[model samples]
Target: MKEERVKKILSLLEKAYPDAKLVLHYNNPLELLIATILAAQCTDERVNKVTETLFKKCKTAQDYASAEQDVFEQEIRSTGFYKNKAKNIIACGKELVERFDGKVPDTMEDLVTLPGVGRKTASVLLGNIFGKQAVAVDTHVFRVSHRLELAKANDPDKVEQELCKIIPQEKWTRSCLVVGTHGRRTCIARKPLCNVCVVEKLCHSPDKIYSSRQE
Candidate 1:
């Protein structure tokens, strides 16, 4: 996409969803790390619901590193993949305590070294928590980027690299939040409401369904 067109799309996206923000609730890096892990195949709403109690119970890395495995699994059972998530959270906590002095590392290199933390997860922490120029490509980002032609690669890491090339570094995180919200709200996977989409005219996806809206 051309720079001017990308600019227009981003401008309209901000206008369309001025309040779009991260749905997973967290006050610190540890909370977000846990919530992101729990959000693997689950909805942000469900992750938030589960983390409401989980955060209070596990406030620090030491708390998680020492949590009983079976009990921790039950705490996050509703998030699905609780067994793996629980195991990772515990091991992640241990790594954090042992290596980073119980603080979440700010760099991608250090963050990815922790258990269960991948590039996507590291990007979230980097962009949101550490105030870094990073774009985390989750399912919504991957789907919407394809629809908008911001990226064409099947691999998400490649897509992220492509997006980084076009989208200004300053707007990387905001653009992802806005576009991801667009995917969740209007550019839905099964039934996209193209008629009500803010970028309908700009989209060239074959799946776009057009109709006159009552509003």
Candidate 2:
């Protein structure tokens, strides 16, 4: 997709959802990290609901590291994949305490080394917590990018690279948040409300059910 067109789409999205932001609720970087891990195959709403109690119980790296496996699993059970998430959360806490002195690493290299922490999670921490320009290519981002032709690759890493090439560095974080929101609100996977989409005219995805331009 052309840079100019991408910019225009972004402009429209910005106007449409000026308040679009990361929906996951977190009090600190560690909470956000844990929430992101739980959010892998779950909704942010579910993660937030689970974290409401989880955070109160596990406030620090040591808390998670020392938590009972079965008990911890039950706490995050509603997030799904609780067994792995529990194991990873405990292991991630140990890594943070042992390697990083119980602090969440701001760099991608260190962050990805933690259990359950991937590029997408790292990008979220980098942009939101560390105030760095990073694009988190989650499910919503991946789908929206492909449909918008902002990226042609199937692999998320390639898509991220493609998006970085086209989207300005300053708008990287905002683009991810806006486009992800668009995917949820307008360009939904099952039933996209194309007629109400702010960027409907700019999008030419074959999957679009209705086009305002056609009207």
Candidate 3:
């Protein structure tokens, strides 16, 4: 509810997950963009496993644009939603080539114009790829922000606004990384491990599991 309290919670999170950061493997902005799209409803680990071979095949926007739909689908089939994702990836590549000259746009406006790219993806790109201030509100960030009482909004965009109001601009990326890590490792969706959570005292989630037996 207060800025000081939110800062303290963020600090605790940093201490809890000292090495927390984006786990999705990528060598460049384009690779990260494709990886982010493929990561929809899929785990980073799984996405990484698929991209291990995908990046080798599709090196550029033209590669993806010209990639045989059937072959690309088969390559990324394990990430789920193969048909739709494949279509989007192809379209995204085409859009980049036609509009941005085969480069990932750094701005939010341009990034969202690409196929399969939403505000969340745009934010991730802005922060990590473009070195701008952004809070990528993925499912984990959304859920964890609510549980921590740092945001009350039902919409991800509104949640980002609420968090930005309390968290410093420089810490936007840090907040997403640490809080998201906490959501995945400690404050989980089904049963949060509040007993061992570093920010448990600051959290007010009704779903918190205070006892080991409860989890």
Ordered from best to worst TM-score, the candidate numbers read 2, 1, 3
Q: What is the overall TM-score of model 2 with all chains considered together?
A: 0.97
Weakest lDDT window of 10 consecutive positions for candidate 3 = 206-215
Pairs that collide, model 2:
none
Please provide, for model 3 over 1-215, each residue's C-alpha lDDT reduced to its tens digit, 9 standing for 90 to 100: 48789889999999989999898999999999999999999999999999999999899999999988899999999999999999999999999999999999999889999999998999988888888999999999999999889899999999989988889999998889999999999989998878899887776678876844423
The reply for model 1, stretches above 4 Å from the true place, is: 211-215
Candidate RMSDs in Å, in order, are: 2.4, 1.2, 2.4
Residue 85 of model 2 has an lDDT of 94
Q: Is candidate 1 or candidate 2 better by lDDT?
A: 2
lDDT of 2 at 149: 89
Give candidate 2's whole-model lDDT: 0.92
lDDT of 1 by residue, 100-171 (tens): 999999999999999999988999989988889899999999999998888999998999999999999999
Off-target runs (Cα >4 Å) in candidate 3 are 211-215
Model 2 C-alpha lDDT per residue in residues 85-203, reported as the tens digit of each score:
99999999999989988999999989999999989999999998899999899999999999888999988888989999999999899999999999988899988998888888878
